[model samples]
Target: MKKILHAGNNLKGKQANPTYISFLGPKLEAVGFTLYYTSQKQNKVLRLIDMLLSVYKYRAKVDLVLIDTYSTSNFYYAFLVAELCNLLKTPYITILHGGNLPKRLDKSTWKSKRLFKHSKLNIAPSKYIMHEFKKRAYSNIKFIPNALNIEKYEVTERGCERLKLLWVRSLTPIYNPDMALEVVRLLQNEGLDVSLTMVGPDPHNKFEELKETINNKKLRIEYKGKLKQEEWYKLSENHNIFINTSNFDNMPITLIEAMALGLPLVSTNVGGIPYLIEDGKEGLLCNKDDALTMVNCIKKIHKNPDLRQSLIVNARSKAESFSWQNVKALWISALA
Candidate 1:
């Protein structure tokens, strides 16, 4: 039996998507891999003593280590794990999860430079990101999207009449939830029969105020904060149209979730979004911050039955490629 240490954050208390950590860790274990977990929050200065102590504690039995990578503060986390891996002489894989990094492992800092330059493998979830890695001239790169069990996957499709537009994202500034709200306002001013549902927990404390502002402006919208994935899954069943208003993103798991559930998307064309959805094909694409374009797409999809069905059918087909059974194999191969 092989042993693996999975180092990452425990987001249960912080209201984060722990899907990548907990779910993928256990699934890897079921395939005869013994797993261990260590939660290291993003951007915390690494206490060299503690990390060295951890290596001494677990080094004897751990055969391999897996570290989840990110572009922001979490990038530091992977570097720390990579250092520990070096000291222990354990083969480690860094699963890069950001949209910004080029596929190459080379970097200016010793941490990234060493990890990219020396790690046994580097796994990116999207080709959009993998190509970024390729620029670094690293040959160990592979693509493996996050894991979602397709057998248990069920999509909820709301009626077009409901016309409930949804944006499932934190109200953090980077996601630009305001753009979705602006679209809501634009459609309302045009007297469109629409209601926007802004789900998920807000990090910036702006959602209630955004909700109030929408009401003051007489826009039709409902702000439901922080829904559990399961609860949101049920809510999504009644939602026929999905919208993503992200400034920059790697492949979004939520968009894929919506696609699998048969939602026709009206998304801003940005980052990995274009890779997942094609204009007038799998889903509709609008320029980022162009509220009226989103408004037009909403009206277009709502009115045309065949067009809506075409998008839904194609979106679901695109989603089949992201199934956990398919994605996990990539991870297993990279690990091997």
Candidate 2:
């Protein structure tokens, strides 16, 4: 069995959504790969130090290092870790996670090359990211969509008489949680009976802003801060529609989970989302921050039961392709 050191945010118990390492690490272990992980420290500087120390400590024992690469400040973590891996003559693979990474590649060309070019392989979770990298002449990359246990997400029967929207993402500016609020407000203004439930952590303290908007607009919105996967899966049963209002996104696992649970999707068509869901096929798509378009999309599903059922069926079918049973083999092969 190959020994792998997975490096990324492992803050499962820290009231944050489980990152890629939290999910993929266990899957790798179950398939006979021994796995070690890094820094659960919430502080940025401390987390970087802990990650570097883990790499140094496991340098001799592990056959490979798996770095969860992102586009923001965490990008520096991957760069420094990869640099250390290079110095130590250890092979490392970068698992790309940020939806805005294409912009990073353009903005930090030299750093991107230094970090990605030297890796054993770069794993892209979406074709959107893969295409971006290939366009920049980065050939040592592969596409592996994020995976989940499809069987765990039981499909729920839904009704359209009263629209219930479900939004799951961190309350961050980039995700544009405000757009979800605006979408709900617009639907209510149209004399439509709509209620929204948001589930996520407020690392940047954006929940207060969301609350103020909800109160001022007098909208029916429930803010369920940071729920466990199963907790929100149960809450999803009450919701008929899933709204993804992110300005930028990669292959979000929540969208797949919503699909598996039989919720019709209405998402902003940005980054890899269109690649994930075909417009008027598996789900409906609108431009970023355009709440009116999203409202119209929801209205279409409300008026047409056939369209809703079709989207639910098609989306669930697409989500099955992302199940761990199907995707584990790809990871096994790639690691080999």
lDDT per residue as tens, model 2, 177-284? 989989988988889999999999888779887788889989999988999889999999998999999999988988989999999999999999999999999999
Which lDDT value does model 1 have at 14?
A: 51
Per-residue lDDT over 1-336 for candidate 1, one digit per residue giving the tens place of the 0 to 100 score? 678877766455454554477778878888777888765443245433344455557888887777777777667667877887887788888777766554223444556678776788887777777776676566778777765766655755457875788789877775788888888788777777778888876666887678677868887778778887777778877667889888777888888888888888999887778877899999999887788888899899999999999998898888887777787667677777
**TM-score for each of the candidates:** 0.90, 0.99
Candidate 2: give the clashing pairs. Answer: none
Residue 204 of model 2: what lDDT? 77
* Candidate 2 lDDT: 0.93
TM-score of 2: 0.99
